[model samples]
Target: MAFSNDVKIKALVACARCCCICHKFCGIKIECHHIIQEADGGSNSFENCIPLCFDCHADMLSYDDKHPKGTKYRPDELKFHRDGWTSKINAARPADYCDEHRKLDQGLFLRILRRLPWNGSIGFISTNNFAGFSFDCRALLDLHELAACNDDPSWEFIDPTLEIARANLAHHVSRFLGLIGMNTFPTDNPDRNSVPEEWERERPEHFFQVVDEIHEAASRCVDSYKTLLREGRRRLAIESPADEEPTSKPKT
Candidate 1:
């Protein structure tokens, strides 16, 4: 479901700066963005969110082709001040958004998750104590072409339930990584500047790239899932006789 209006307002109200692109600074005309996507299982919770102008949002959406869950600045990219604004978003995010696609089996959903490369696993969060890719993306395995982790024994689907659990875990991890941007190494994204370099050279293509990447990953995930049901053993994978697929992940 689309995020609620109430959530939107709360997010906007917390804005610290106007959007870099549009100069808008409020929710009605401007917009708020979670560094991590609420759809990617990122929480609507304030800790992982940011408010921006519609122009800035548009700019970011056009910033890269590989962005689906949107992007995040690297941890070290932000600036710190005297009052103690640490300049780091919590960077926590959920692993999946099964609720958004309520027409698939657990196993198939997992097959899709397996195919998606966990880019965030490189260095995305500080969960309680975790840092620099503290988690294992190998366990978040599946099958695919464009973004496979190429882990053979690394991915072994047990039953449908276990597979779903693994995918759910992967969903959160992906959310975490995407919330931190393409690289988690040091969060080196530049701060709010007048204009960035990429804007001049090939911006529209960059936006198209983000669109393509998200579509490719999401489409691949959805498409493979259908195949999973036919060739696999998730109860709901069959054409007719089966159980209902599970719902959203446990609230994280």
Candidate 2:
């Protein structure tokens, strides 16, 4: 079966584009091997696929002198190695490696900034205005982005500041959606009016307060991201040399 780009990306992300057996990165190319061969009744699903370098793939399908040539490797053995390496790669992911997630976070922050009032009062803004915040923002800063982040190790950095900011925004958006008879959350009381009874009691003052708090929290996350980028760049500069030195000095 021909592999789709989505399936290939999923496999690469799961194994970090490395060979499952020898556990070495394949650089640009890695072959997608079926954990259970399709010829042996294996479907072309995600669970049935594994990423391997050409050499490792050959080794998996071959038997050395220690074993008879006719004997082939078992699927479970390959699966075990793949699972172990996937876990190690995910665990070793750098804290500041979330470029895509960071972009989504920034996108949502920009949208929120646009909606906020110049006077810092959200009471004037209706709940209907921010409903789109729940939509997936390129696999970050959205309700569904969590699944993407979970699947991709590179996007797994959990910035506490970003979490707090997102939670603040989600709370406000969820409350607004809840008040409008939308059932996105179990806590949503759809029986209430559009404005909700509790919020009605708090009125504009509570609305303003929530807006101010969320804005401040999200702004802090932005600053934290900038600091993280600076630290990461500085570390890279120190760890990597600008040019490679000669292995031996001149013979003169």
Candidate 3:
């Protein structure tokens, strides 16, 4: 059964119209997801609802318990995330939105910037040839974690524009990761790289097509991140360093 209107409204308000998982300000692009599947006898109560963005909702449903790959977000974990976010939103005071509180945190912004991949991970994926390539999965893992950091309350920008830009960057990065599949290269060894078996045997044309798609997604991620950085710097009144911008794809 679908969530009732009351339940949906409550969830939306509690999450402040942002996604509970990524904490991105989704505006009207948010959805009420069932923490437990309806097929599993999950109810349509407010307690069973989770507010998520389109990408996060898809990710939550994509996990297959029967053939589990990566770590699945359990129902309890979803509840924890939802409850914690709601508490924060509810505890926020009106004065928190005053001009004094809207000042940008330069140190916080710098820390977040340091966590981003810059021209490293996304740059490599967008510019490299993926054929017969066993990508170092650790890089992707790091990127995912960096993107997920957007959900941390400490990362929230007081400026609405900056926060929106940050959310856009996180959304794009998460979308790119979703397209690639987080555990696409599940490995027993942490140091092992993940090579798509099909890439080795598929027709050259087909392989190139897949590579092109990945390149496009990775490029979008880079663009979103660049936008965030630009907005962040402007909000913080910080000048960009000489080498702050991503350079052209490195010559092989």
Candidate 4:
């Protein structure tokens, strides 16, 4: 049988609506997973329930015992992780927990800044024409890495305002990357940027439309990133580097 409302609510509350395994704040995007499958006689009790995010829930269920590629998460391990995380969440005061989250979030924002430096390719893409502009392959890799981290549970901001800003930045970054991937082609020169796809020549209007979309998307990414940086610094007390200028123009 499925977990009852009481069991689900209790598990979610114990984990503060965060994934028990990754500790990512999931809010409404969380599920109460059974530690032991119901088919295996797992009861619909709070003790058998573990709150998890959508991705973690999928991973938890993907273990193929017969065709095992790697070690699967054991039931004992899942219980340990759930109990440990829930204990921590239930023990800490709201203010203290938020303080710890703020510190971790500062580091996360710093990592993001490193990937998208103020005078780096992101800024360049925001200001330059997309017609002949090519983004550095390495920069694209950094963006991909940053995008991947959006789902990572570690270092998720607990502050609602900061979380909202982070989500906005992630959305814009993903949009920018999607537009580029669809419209660009890799070049032989490793040091140079990827060039626009040859198909653009066959459909000039469509190409222009994509170019405008890309430019707008890039601008939104930069704007959202800057907003995150400002909010993180102000609310989380993040320190900016002395040599780095957050307001500096993109490198020409």
Candidate 5:
């Protein structure tokens, strides 16, 4: 069969959901433009299409015009394929983020993190496998940007595998917390409305306060361990345990 009708509908739905990148961002317009011009040798394929701001489409067609009267593109331009989140934005994205952010591998927020004089130690806790935790970093960076902008979406997935990856990652986070004694977070409400309800009334708090307390307890335990280590080091420093202080014979 030719291009699936569902695919085209997906493209259109994405455009409307993001408002064609028109409403939220500067460069995006409401049209999905073919990266490789349809006239040359391109076919109706997902790779050939990208969501373009209206002006970008026109600018792309005219790119060669800037060079000369009979100028041409390098063969690479015709066959090029951008990868990662950038490609996702071009293909389609959540309604909240702009095309510019979507097209980024690390997106805009991490770009700022990279630029800083110090490498920020942002700890991401998730499953070890790429299949499990790959999307967490990119999604987190995007969420950081969203918060900065004071707007966002419920979720973002860069790859089809991302959904499964996230579920596994959540498992890891839960397991890690269990090891440390913190418990389920956010709330017990099935709907997660953030409203107080009867189910949570039985629980002390609807958040991870116990988790914080356990961490503090763990820190104090380390001090006792350190004292043992220091005592051992002092004993090791002396050739013997001072010869057991020479047995004192009591003279009666």
Candidate 6:
């Protein structure tokens, strides 16, 4: 039996819409594949599905020895890839996606919450707060990458917030790089910005404000992602099998 649309969509999202074997982002349509072929009695469930772009899907299905480039993937190997990708994504994904994925997402969120700067004993510092700011910048960048790599329209909700956060972060990074007398930043980066005339070291207060804006934008973006995820999950659940129990976290 063919997997339900819910399972197929969930599998695509869980894998971040990239081919597991080739690890390439597909701009075109991806096909949902069965690790165990349906003809072999494989159940049409999330755990049994994998997402592959057309080329990779064709390669996987081709078992001809003459086609050396076409590597045949074992069912267990595909499952491992799915499980590993799911774990990585769960760290950054929201709980509204799927119940099977939510357990890991919740655990990762708790871990992130525990690491946040909430220590009451220490007062907040202003200048040269590179570590904390850099962490947030990297996180936003990761989310942006996820959206780009998946090419999924569902992630459009957070695009504007990401743009604002990236702009703010880029300005900060450029200012820092300029302080060290570097003339150029990465040219290919969409977020790269030139150091502005007003971004001098004496204007530390203004710099802090930019950082605050970045943090605020990031928080808003995170909330928006959670909202979209909840909506997506709700829609998926409406199409899901009623008796289906969400898969538990796979053994690590």
Clashes of each: 11, 0, 0, 0, 3, 0
Strongest candidate by TM-score: 4
Error of 6 at 123 (Å): 48
Residue pairs with clashing backbones, model 2: none
Q: Give TM per candidate.
A: 0.25, 0.36, 0.57, 0.59, 0.27, 0.35
Q: What is the C-alpha lDDT profile of model 5 across 115-150, one tens digit per residue?
A: 211111112212111111112223224223322332
Give lDDT tens digits, candidate 6, residues 80-185. Answer: 8667555545544444546755444344333322332112101111122321222222322333333332323222222222222222233232333333223222
CA lDDT of each prediction against the hidden true structure? 0.36, 0.47, 0.70, 0.72, 0.34, 0.45
Report the C-alpha lDDT of model 4 over 1-252, residue by residue, as the tens digit: 688897787788887787777665678988888888888888888888888888789887887888887668778899997987776667653455666676677787787778667666665655656675565666556668778887675645656556656766776778788888777776677555543556467877777787778767877877787787788788767675433433433332
The residue-by-residue lDDT of candidate 2 on 95-122, one tens digit each, is 6547765555454444433333222222
Choose 1 or 2, whichever is better by TM-score.
2
Give residue 40's error in model 1 in angstroms.
3.7
Per-model root-mean-square deviation over C-alphas: 19.9, 20.2, 6.5, 6.1, 22.3, 16.4
Which scores higher on lDDT, 1 or 5? Answer: 1
Better lDDT candidate (3, 5): 3
**Which of the predicted structures, 4 or 5, would earn the higher TM-score when compared with the native?**
4
Q: Name every residue pair that clashes in candidate 3.
A: none
lDDT for model 3 comes to: 0.70
Q: What is the lDDT of residue 164 in candidate 1?
A: 33
* Most accurate candidate by lDDT: 4
TM-score sort, best first? 4, 3, 2, 6, 5, 1
The residue pairs found clashing in candidate 6 are none
Q: Worst ten-residue run, lDDT, model 4? A: 243-252
